[model samples]
Target: MDLDQSVIGLTSNEYVFEVERRHVGQFAAAIGDDHPLYTDEEYANQSAYAGLIVPPTFPIAMNDGKTEMPLALDQRRMLHGEQEFLYYKPIRIGDRLRCQIKVSDLYDKEGKSGKMQFLKLDTEMKDETGELVCISRMNIVYRSLAN
Candidate 1:
């Protein structure tokens, strides 16, 4: 079995994008979590957070657009295995956030089906003020076609 590895790291300076209230709203709608914290400002104020907040999983739910950090995952055989998030600060409405993703680990396993490769990604998110917000770990499993 041949194991090819790659590291994909990006800093906040490299990724020039912002997540606004509208984006948060759309994400909330798509996830079916129509909570006030994710939609209405007025309603959000009544909660623990002073303003509207984005969903916890919003950071990892981004569609694979050009803005996304490039990955070597074989898209055809890629599968979302697991995800874990660690939040240090609150992500509120009107707060701009940036994330840099990189390959944390890569390896191939000789599974019964075939040679399955695991690509582990670590995404660090921060606020405008250079404060760490959350760190998300994503695992993608790729199984080769040959048995």
Candidate 2:
């Protein structure tokens, strides 16, 4: 698809995710993290977070295509670029998080291969109390095959 500036501000529907002990432990295990905070309820209960917590990258698992882009782009031409996460609060078990994805920016740049369109998407997650939990920024590059 051509670079569409209008898609910059487009946002996806909000998705709510409930953090579960099983899910957190599984995610931690999948990543080979044996930290007690992620799996040991007794140990985690005494930590500063006061309960079982998820690994730093656990939010990636929470995103199951629930917040897809409002517009469709050719997957063949899309390339995953960079991802950044900013945490405002710790993600703990039993916390309900409401998340929505927004297209924050759309721009084009000249690459060694060809002109590339960059799509920046931001996922903002808030707790049930409407407090900011975290924000994940993802960058995608769309390159023309003709290049």
| Candidate whose TM-score is highest | 2
TM-score, candidate 2, is 0.89
Per-candidate TM-score against the hidden true structure: 0.76, 0.89
What does candidate 1's lDDT look like per residue over 1-147, in tens digits?
333653534322235346677887888888899777777779888888777778999877543365555554456787889998888887766665677776777888888987788877777777888888878888888777664
- Candidate 2 residues lying further than 4 Å off, grouped into runs, are 45-50, 64-67
Q: Which pairs clash in model 2?
A: none
Candidate 1 — which residues are off by over 4 angstroms? 1-13, 40-43, 61-64, 68-71
Consecutive 10-residue window with the lowest summed lDDT within model 2: 62-71
Give the distance in Å from residue 11's predicted Cα in candidate 2 to where it truly belongs. Answer: 0.4
